[model samples]
Target: MDSISSRIEKVNPSLTLAVTNQAKAMAARGEEVYGLAGGEPELDTPDHIKAAAIVALQEGRTKYTASGGIPELREGLAAKLAADNDLEYEPKQICVTAGAKMACFNAILAVVEEGDEVIIPSPYWVSYPEMVRLAGGTPVIVDTLESDGWKMTPEQFEAAMTPATKMVILNSPSNPTGAVYSEEELRAIGEVALYEDIVILSDEIYEKLVYGETKHVSIASLSQELYDLTITVNGFSKAYSMTGWRLGYTAAPPAIAEAIIKIQSHSVSNATTFAQFGGVAALEGDQTFITDMREEYDGRRQFMLARLQAIHNVRVVEPKGAFYFFVRTGDIGLKSQNLCDKLLSRYKVAAIPGVAFGYDDGIRLSYCTTLDILNEGLTRFEQFCREH
Candidate 1:
C-alpha cells in the first residue's frame, strides 16, 4: 500500500462523529436507537427560511457570489451582528463561510503557523484539538474544575498564554457541558486578551439556545479592545434549525476577514448561494421561530436535567444554556466510552462518551430528541445504572 499524507495520518478522527456513526449503524439494523450523539438541533427548518431560498433560486441567485459572500448577505449579517451582539461591523469585515466549523478552520489557518499554540478549556469541544493539530498548531488544554461549572478562570487564562499562544477558543453555552459564562466571566477573560494581544475565537454557535433567565453575551460587546481581538463565529444551525443549510459566518477584524476570504476562495469558494438567501431571511424575518424553538428546548433541558439527577451515582449540573446534560456517573466506574457502548448495545440509547470532550470519566447526553423519547431513554438509563 502507498503511504498516506503525514498530516492526515497524524490527526485522529472526530470522536463525536465516531459515536454518531456507531449509532447510525445500529439504527440501520432496525434497532430502536434513541441517539443523542450529535449536537445538531432535531427540529425542522422553519418554512419561511425555506421559502426565501426558493425565491432566490427563481431570481437567478444560483450563480457564484463574491468570494467572501454576496453583498446582500454581508449587509444583513452586519446588521444582525450589530443588533444582536451589540458590535458594529461593516459588510466587508464579515465573511460568510460553509459553517461555523469552517469559519473557525479558516481563522486558525489564517492566523496560526507551525508551532503556534491554541489554548482550549478541558471538556473542550472535540474538534478544537484536532483542528489545531491539522493546522500545524499545538492545542494547550486548560482544565476547568467542576466546581466552577467547567469554565476557565482569568488566572488560568493568563497562565496558559505564552509567546507561542496565538489564539484562544471560547464556547459559550458550551457543547458537551452546556455551560454559559456570565458577563463578568467574559470581561475577566477579555482583560487577559487585552494584556496579551492574543486572538479570541469566540464560538457562539449555541448563543441563542440558552435556557431560563440566562442570555448570550458576545465578548466583543464587553469592550472596544475585545471587539477588536475577538472573532465572533456563529451560524443558523442550532438557533434557526438550519443545520442542513450549511450557513455560518465570522465577524472578524478587517485583516483577518481578508485572509479568511482568501482561504475560502481557494477551498469552498462560496457556501451554497441559495442558503445565503435563506440566511438573509433568517436574520431579517420573523425571529419568533427561533424564540419558539428555544422555549421548547428549555422545557426539555429542565426535564432531562431532573431525570438524570434521579440516577443514584450520576451528578449533573443543570446547563445554563444549550441542550446537553454532561453527567458525572461516578458509581459505574467504567470508562465513558465503555459505558456509552454498553448503554447503546443493550438499552438502544446512544449518548456520547465524554472522552471526546477531554472528560474521560463522564458522558454527554444531548437532549435534542423528543420529550417522549427522552423519558423512555431515561427509564432505560436508570435501569442500566441499577443493574451495573
Candidate 2:
C-alpha cells in the first residue's frame, strides 16, 4: 500500500455531506430528521426540461459529443450571457462542464499554478478553500464585515493580494449567506483586480435565484478587459432544478477555456449527453419556472429568517437572494458543531455547523425544502435555542 496523496490528505471530507450523512444514518435507525444541510432544491425538474432529455434519448443523442459541450448548448449559453449580462463571448470561449463545481475547479486549475494564492472571502462556499488547497495553492481568505452585508472591501482585497496572487474567487448570492453584491461594491473589487492583473473567478450560479428585485451584476460585463480576465461560472442547478443533471458552464478567455478542456479530456470526458439537451432547453425554454422558484424561495427566506431572528442571542443576516441563512450563535455560549449536534440528535433537525464555512460560532440552514418542512425545522431549532 502506497501512501495516499498529500493533496487529498490535506482536505477534509465535505462538511455539508458529513452532516447530511449523519442525518441519513439516524433516519435509517428510525429517528425522523429534517435536513437543512443539503443545498439542492426539493422541487422536481419541470416537464419541459425533462421532455428535452427524453427527446434527446429517443433521437439517439446518447453518444459523447464534444468534450467541452454540445455545440448548440455551448452557443446558447454564450448567447444567453451576451444578452443577459452584456458580455460577449464566442462558443470557443465557453466550456460546459459536469457542474458548476467542475467549472470552477477547471478554471482554477487552468489558470493557477501551484503555490499561487486564490483569494476567498470568509464565510465562503464550503468548497473554495478546499479546492484551492487541492490545487496546491494557498487559500488567502479575506473577511467581510457583517456591517457591509458580508461583502469584502477593496482594502481587504488589496491586503490579501501578493506577488504570487493568481485568482480571486467570489460568489454573488453567496451559498451560505445569500448576500448579493451591489454593482458599486463589485466594481470597486474589479478596479483593484484590474490594477493588480489578478484574474477573477466569479461564481454566479445563483444569478437567476435572486429575490426582491435585486439585480446580479457580472464583473465581466463592466469592460472588455475585465471580461478577458474574469471567468464567469454558472449552471442549471440552482435556477432550473437540475442539480442532478450535473450541467455547468463557464465563459472565459479562449485560451483558458481550452486549457480547462484539456483537463476535462482526461477526467470524466464530457457531461451526460441527455443532460446537455435538458440544459439547452433550460437556457432557451420558458423562464417562468425561474420566476416562480424565486418567488417561492423569497417566501421561505422570509419565514426562516424571521423564525431564526426570534431566537435570543442568535445573529442571522436577512438574505437578499439565494435560499440560505448563515446564523451566528456564538452568543449562545456553545461552539457551533456542538450546537448543531445537539439540534440533530436531540431535536432531529440537521444543519451545517458554521465551522464548515470557517465560522465556528454559527450554523447554516437551507430554505430550499418544503415550507411545511422548513417551518417545522425552524420550530425545532427555535426550541433548541430556548432550551440552551
Candidate 3:
C-alpha cells in the first residue's frame, strides 16, 4: 500500500475518546465502570426542537439546501448573535456548519497558511492544536497560571506573539479547565490583537452554560474593530442539549464567510436539513429549559467540587462554567496518563488524561453524569489516590 498523506500523520486521536472507550470495553466484560470523560449533556433534546425537526421532515425538508445554509437559519442566527452577544451581522455573514468543531476548523483553514503561527492557551480543548496542525500552522502554546484562574493575560499573549502569528484561538468556558474570561480580561487581549492585526477565533459554544454570577461575554461584542477581526463560533450542542443534531454556526466578516462557504461547498456542504429547522426552534423557542439545565449543572458542580476537596493532596480550581473540573495530579507523583490509567484499571473510574489536551500535570473529569455515579466514581478515585 502507498503511504498516506503526511498531514494525516500530524493529527492525534482524541484523548477524551480514548478514556471513554476503555471504560466501555471494561463494562462490556462485566466489570463495574463509571465514565466521567464525555463533554455532551446527558439531558434529552427539548420537545419543541424535536417537534420542529419532525414537522420539517413530514413537510419533505430533507433535501439539500444552499451550501451556506437555509436563509431562515442564517437570519435566526444573526438575530440571536445580535440579541445575545451584542454582535451585529447580516444573514450573508453567517454560515451554518456540521458542528461548532467544524466551524472552528473551517475558520482556521480559511485564514491560516503554511508556516503561520496560531496561538492557543494551555489546558485547551483537545482538538485546537491538532486542527491548527492539519491546516499547516504551528501551534504556539501559551501557558495560563493556575493561580490566575487558568486564563491568558495580556502579558502572556504578548510573549506568545511573533511576526509569523496569524490567529489567536480563544475558548471561554474552556473544555478542560472551564475557566471563563472576564470582559476586562478579554478587552485587554483584544487590544493586543488589534495592535498586532491578528484574527481571533472565538469559540463560545458553552456560553449559556455558565453558572451563578459568572456571565458570558463575547469578545467580538466588545468593539466594532474586534468584531471585524473576529469569527464567532457557537452551536446548539451544549445550550440546547442537541449534540446529536450536529448543528452549529459561525458569524464572520463577509470575505471570511465566503471563504468558509467555498470550503463547505466542496466538503460536507450544509448541515443537516431538518436539523437546521430544529436549530431555529432551539433559538426561538422558550428558553426556560436552559435556565433549568443551568441550575442543575450548578448543583452538580458544587457537589463534585466538595467531593474532590475532601480528597487530600489533590488540587482543583473551581470551574466557573462548563461541566468539567481539571484536577492537578502532581502531588500524587504520577503523570496524568498513569494516574488516569490507575483510576480506570484499578478503581473503575474513567477520566481524561491531561496530556491529551496539551497539559501533563492533571486529568479532567466531567460532572455531567448522575450524582450517584459521581459519588461512587469519586469515592473510588479518592481510595486509589490514598492507596498509591
Candidate 4:
C-alpha cells in the first residue's frame, strides 16, 4: 500500500468516541455495562425540530444549499447570536457546516498554516490539538492548575504567545473539565488576544448546558476588537439533543467567514439540506426544552458530585457547567489509561482517561446518563479505587 500523507498520520482517533463505542459494543453482547464516557445527552430530539425536518423532506428540500448554508438558517443563526450570546453578526458573516467539529476544523484550516502555533490549554477537548496538527500548525499546550478551577489565566495566555503564535482556542464550559469562564476572565483573556493580534477560535457548543449561577459568555461579545478576531462556533447537538442531525455553524469576521465558506465549498459543500431546516426550527421555535434539559442535568450533576466527593481515593472539583466530573485518580497510584482499562474490564464501567485531554493523572466521568446508571458506575468505580 502507498504511504499515507504525513499530516494524516499526526492525528489521533477521538478517545471519547473510542470509549463510548467499546461500551456500546459490550452492551450489544448482552453484558452489563454502565456507560459514562459519551459527551452527548441521552434525550431525543425535540418533536418540533423533527417535524420541521420531516416537512422539508416531504417537500423535497434535499437539494444542495449554498456552500455557506441556506439564507434562512444563517439569518436565524445571526439572530440567535445577537439575542442569546450578545454578539452581533450579520448573516453574510456566518458559515454553516456539518457539525460543530467541522466548524472548528474549518476555522482552523482557514487560518492556520505550517510553522504557525495555536495555543490550547490542558484538559482541553481532545480534538483541538489534533486538528491543529492536521492544519499543519503546531499546538502549544499550556497546563492549567486544579487550584485555579482548571482555567487559563490572562498571564498564562500572554506568556504562551510568541512571534509564531497565530491563534488560541477557547472552550467555555470546557470538555473533560467542565470549567466555565466568567465574563471578567473572558475580558482579560480577550484583551491579551486583542493586543497580540491572535485569532480566537471560541467553541461554545455547550453554551446552554451551564448550571447554578454559572453563565456562558462569548469572548467575541466582550468588545469589537475581540469580536473581529473571533470565530464563534455553536450547534444544536448538545442543546437540542440533535446529535444525529449533523448541523453546526460559525459566526466569524467577514474575511475569516469567507475563508471558511471557500473551504466548505471545496470540502463538505454544505451541511445536510433538510437538516438545516431542523436547525432553523431549533433556533426559532419554543426554547422551553433547553431550560428543562438544563434543570435535569443540574440535578444529575449534584448527585454525581456528592457521590464522587464521598469516595476515599478520588478528588473532584465541582463542575459549574456541562455534565462531567474530571476527577483526580492519581492518588490511587495508577496512570489514567491503565486505571480506565481495569475499570472497564473488571468493574464493567466505562470512562474516558484524562490523558486524552492532556492530563495523565485524572479521568473524565460524564453525567449524561441516568441516575441509576451513574449510581452503579460510581459504586463500581469506588470499589475499584479501594482495591487499588
Candidate 5:
C-alpha cells in the first residue's frame, strides 16, 4: 500500500540538495569534486553570536518560550526592521520560525488555500511552488526573461492575475538568479498587488549580500499599503553564516502574524530556544561580519563573472546580489540536467541544474566558496563547455 497524501505526492525533492549531497558523498569517498551547488555562505558565524547562544545554554535558557519567538528576539527584530529596512513592525506582529523557509511555509499555510492562485515568477527558489502546492494552492508560474535580468515586470504580474489569485512570491537578490528588484520596480509590483488585493510574500534572506551599486530595497517598506499587504521573511542563514542554527522570522500584519503563530504553535512549537538568543545577538551585536562577507563575495563575483564571460559558448549576467550565478548553457546544446550530470560525473564539478529553478537552458553556480575551489571548478567547467 501506497498511503502518501496527495500533497506529499505533488512535492518534488529539492534538486539543489540532491546535487550538493551527491557531491558531498563523492568527496567523502576521496573523489575530487569542486562543489558549487550549495546555497549557504562558507564563512563562519561570528564569535559573538555563538557566544550568546553558549551563554543562553549556561543560563538554562533551553526551555521552550513563546510559540512565535522569545520576547527579546522578537523585540530585536522589530527594532532591526524599523532601523534597517524602514518597515515599522511591532514585536507582536512577528513570528519567528525554524528557518526563513518555514516562515515562508507558515505564511502560505495561513493565507493560501484550495483554489487559491499564487503568481510566482519563474527561475524562482525551487521551494516556492512546492510550498504552494502543499498548501493546496495553484502556483501560476510566470516565466521571466533573462533580458529583463530574470525579474518579473509589473506588466507580467498584471497579466497573470485572476480573480482566484491570492498571492505573489517575490525574491529579491533571488537565489537562482540573484536579481535584486529596484525600489521603483517593487513599488510598481506592489501597486498591482494592492489593487488586486493579492497578498505579497517578500523573501529577503539575501538582503545583506548585495554588491556594487545595487541596493536592496524591501517592498513592504515602500508604502503603508504595501506593508499591510506583505509578509516579509528573513533569516540568519545567509548573512550570519548560521544555516545550522535554524532561526528566521516573518513580519506581517496583525491578523496574519497571529495566524502564523497559531500554525507554528501546533507544529514546530517555536524555533530552538538557545538559538533564538543567538538570533538576538545577530540583530544587536557587531555587524562588521556582514560587511566583511559582502566584500569577499563581491570580489569572487567579479572574478567569476570575468572568467565565465571569457569562456566559449557560456553567458552569464553579473549578479547584483547573492552568491549564485545563473548561467545560460543553451549554447552548449544539452539541457541543464544532462549538462550538470556530465559536469559532476566527468569533470568533477557539481552545479545545480537550472531545471530546478524553472529554467532548463541554464545552471546555477554558487561562488560562496574559496577562490582556489572556484578556480578549479571554472577550469573544469570551461573544459566541459569547450568539449560539449
Candidate 6:
C-alpha cells in the first residue's frame, strides 16, 4: 500500500531555511560562514513584553481560551487595526493563529477551493504559492518587473484575472524585495479587485519596518469595498522580535473570520496562551522599542545598499522597507541556484536564490543579522563577483 499523501509530494523545502541550515552545518564543522538567508530580527524580544508573558504564566493562564484568541488580545488587535491601519474590525472579525504564516494559510484554505486560481505576484514570499497549492488551488503567478520596483501594476493584475480567479496576495515592504507599495498603487490595485470582485489577501507583517518617507498603507483602509473583499494578515514576529512566540492575527469579514476559526479549531486550536498575553502587551504597551529597532534596521539597510551598489553589475532597486535586498545577478553567467550554491560553499556566505521566490536573475540577502556578519558576507559577495 502507498503510504504518504500526495498533498505534499510536490512541495519544495523552504529555500531560506535550507540555505540557513546548510550554513549552520558548515559553521558547526568549523567553517567561517555568514548566514544572511533568514529574515529574523537580531534584537531580543522587548523586556516589557516578556514581563507580560511572565505575568500571564505566573497567573496560570496556560489553558486555551478561544480558538480565535483570548478576548483581551483580540480586543487589542481590534484597537490596533482601527488606530494604526484605519481599518475597523470588531473583535469578532479577528482570528488569532499560530503565526502570520498560519493566518495566511488559514485564509487561503478557508476561501480557496480545488481548481480555484490565486494570483500571486512574482518575487513573492516562498510560502504564498505553496500555501495555495496546499489548499488545492492553482497558483496564477504574475510577473512584476524590476523597472517598476517589482510591484504588480493594476493592468498586470487585471490581465491575470479570469472567471476562476478566487484571490490575490499582496505583500507590502515585501519579503525578499522590501518593496513598499504606495497608497496610490494599492488603491489602484484595490480598484481592480473591486471591479473584478476578487478577494485580496494583504500581508502586512512588516508594516512597521519602513524606511524614510515610505509609509505602509493597508489597502482595506482605502475604501469599504476593498475592506469587504480583503483579509488583512499581520503578526508580532517582525515588529516585536517575537518570531519564536508564534503569534499572529487576521482581520477579515465576519463570515471569513468565523471560517478561519472553524478550520483552526479543528487543526492547531489556538496560539500559545502566554504568547497571546505578550501580543496584547505588544499592542497596548509602550511602542518606543519599535522605533529603536526601525532606526537600527534603517542604518543596516543603508550600509547593505551602499556595499551592494559598489559591486559592479549587481544592480539593486533601493528597498524602502523590510530587511532584504534582492540583488539582480543576471550579469553573472549562472543560474540563481547555482550562484547561491557557489557563494555558500566557496565563500561561506548564505543567501537565498531568487528562483525560490519565483524570480530568476537574482538572489535575496537578508540584512537582519548584525553589522559585522553583514560586512563579512558582503565582502565575500564582492570577492565572488570579482572572481566570477
Error of 3 at 215 (Å): 0.9
Which residue runs does candidate 6 get wrong by more than 4 Å? none
Choose 1 or 4, whichever is better by TM-score.
4
| Poorest stretch of ten by lDDT in candidate 4 | 1-10
Residue 288 displacement in candidate 5 (angstroms)? 0.6
Residue range with the least summed lDDT across 10 consecutive positions in model 2: 304-313
Estimate the TM-score for candidate 1: 0.97
List ranges where model 4 is wrong by over 4 Å: none
lDDT of 4: 0.93
Model 2 Cα displacement at 55 (Å)?
1.7
Predicted structure with the largest lDDT when compared to the true one: 5
The alpha-carbon deviation from the true structure for residue 337 of candidate 5, after best TM-score superposition, in angstroms, is 1.0
Q: Give lDDT for model 6.
A: 0.93
lDDT of 1 by residue, 243-285 (tens): 8888899989899889989999999999999999999888888
Q: Local distance difference test, per candidate? A: 0.89, 0.89, 0.92, 0.93, 0.94, 0.93
lDDT of 4 by residue, 125-212 (tens): 9999999999999999999999989999999999999999999999988998999999999999998998879999999999999988
lDDT of 6 by residue, 121-151 (tens): 9999999999998899999999999999999
- Model 5 ranges with Cα > 4 A deviation: none
Candidates 1 and 3 compared: the better one by TM-score is 3
**Cα deviation of 346, candidate 4, in Å:** 0.4
Clashing pairs for model 1 are none
Query: Which residues of candidate 2, in runs, are more than 4 Å off?
Result: none
Q: Residue by residue across 1-388, what tens digits does model 2's lDDT show? A: 8689979988888889899889989999988898888788888999999999999999999898788899999999888998888888889888889999999998888887889998999899989998899889999988787788888899999998999999999899898899999998888999999998999999999998888878999998988888888999999998998998999988888888889888888898998999999999988899999889888888888888778877887988788878889888888888988999889989999999988888787789998998887888988888888888
Off by over 4 Å in 1: none
